[model samples]
Target: MADPIKDTRRMIAEMQPRLHPGKYVFCSGIRDDLAADVANVAKGSFVEDEGMSFIIPQEETDRLGIAGGVAMRQITLMVRSALDGVGLTAAVSSALATHGIPANIVAAARHDHVFVPADRAEEALAILLARQAEAQVGS
Candidate 1:
């Protein structure tokens, strides 16, 4: 019998330390109402204040916000190797898809993070944790 959770964890173990678990919320960078409401908001590499309108884990937020709805999830990502190509992303995406978990992956030079709907964060964590476990066992 194939244990999906075990397999997923195996994949995660082989990657770099990428997941930083926390409540990631969207906030305004420049204190602009339009930017706050829009789907596109600036991601702060460093949070000036934890009380900011939308404060996630200081590490999870990026320096620049792209054109996508940010979904907060508890499961952290383990990015394998420098994100020089899209292979890792495609693999992660496919894995998530198979689990019926929808995800939007953003890959940076140093690491990669996944944004899933806030409502689905727990479920997403279970999936990611499984992946992490799988990676550990394999290694």
Candidate 2:
């Protein structure tokens, strides 16, 4: 495995945002049998207390009867960011906020994933790319 990046600036500059294929929905109450069902159909991030707020494909959501409405698309930041890294999420979210994009971020062991409105996925990606470009030029 490669070393995780700790520099906030480098992380942002090199985070090649890649759009995940498929429309996804946010689901909750994925415990017990429901949890098992979700596991079989889709993979997603789980947060305790907040319940499982992970992205499940729309088709899987519909077939599994998971209650989700707002359609979203996943944009994975292809930067191996350290979990302890600072300012990465802040910078990304700030840029998106400036563009009036709502971002639901999930930081995994290796990468950060942002879920944005399905219709604005392209726009969100452009915003992220621009942020990265600015970081590169500023460095």
Candidate 3:
């Protein structure tokens, strides 16, 4: 794998955000015993105070009878960003917030993922792309 980018500006300029190709939903209240089962089917899962929160495909949500809310779509930042990198999330979230889009961010070892309302996925993408373009021009 390529070295993770450390420069905040370059990270934003080359992040190459890509939208995952499906609708996802947030489901909670999954019992610990069932966490493994849900994880096996979910695209992403996180532990929360309420229970395990699973970001699962809409189809699986229906199939598993999981209570889902706020259908969302994932935008994967294709930059290999360092775990301790600063400013990337702030910049992305600020851009999205300016457009009144709520962004739920997940930072993994290799990349950052943003989940936005399913209906506003394209708009969110446009904002991110524009941010990147502007960063490139500035640099």
Candidate 4:
């Protein structure tokens, strides 16, 4: 694997944001046999006092009998960013927010995943690409 990027500009310049297909939703209170099949495939999940919160595919909601509200799309940052990388998230989120797009960032070991509303996904991806280009030019 490549060394994780730390420079804010470099990280943004190379974070090739790829918008994934399909819609997803955030739900909670799922902790039963019905959830077994979808558990491993969840884009993100966490355990809270109320229940198990999950960012799952919208299609899975039907079989799980959960309300899949607010369809979203996942955009994976292709740049390998260090866990402590500064400014990358802020820069990306700010760019999207400026255009009235809400972003939920999930930072993992390899890269950062962004979830944005499905309807606005194309616009969000375009914004991120523009940000990347701007960073590249600045570099």
**Candidate 4 Cα misplacement greater than 4 A, ranges:** 31-33
The candidate that wins on lDDT is 4
Residues 1-139, candidate 3: write the lDDT tens digits. Answer: 7888889999999989999988988788876776777899888778777667778888887777777798899999999998888789999999999999999998988999999999999999999999999999989
**Tens-digit lDDT track of model 2 for 5-56:** 9998999999999998889887777657678778766657667675666667
Model 3: lDDT equals 0.90
The TM-score, computed over Cα atoms with residue i paired to residue i, of candidate 1 is 0.50
Clash pairs detected, candidate 3: none
TM-score versus the correct structure, for each prediction: 0.50, 0.89, 0.93, 0.93
Q: What TM-score does structure 3 among the candidates reach?
A: 0.93
Could you tell me the lDDT of residue 89 within candidate 3? 96
lDDT-based ranking = 4, 3, 2, 1
lDDT of 4: 0.91
Ranking by TM-score: 4, 3, 2, 1
For model 4, what is the error of residue 107's alpha carbon versus the real structure, in angstroms, after optimal superposition? 0.7
- In the range 82-128, model 4's lDDT, one tens digit per residue, is 99989999998999999999999988889999999999999999999
CA-only RMSD, every prediction = 10.2, 1.8, 1.5, 1.4
Please list all clashing residue pairs in model 2, or write none if there are none.
none
Model 4, total clashes: 0
Q: What's the lDDT for residue 133 in model 2?
A: 99
Angstrom error of the Cα, residue 75, model 2: value is: 0.4
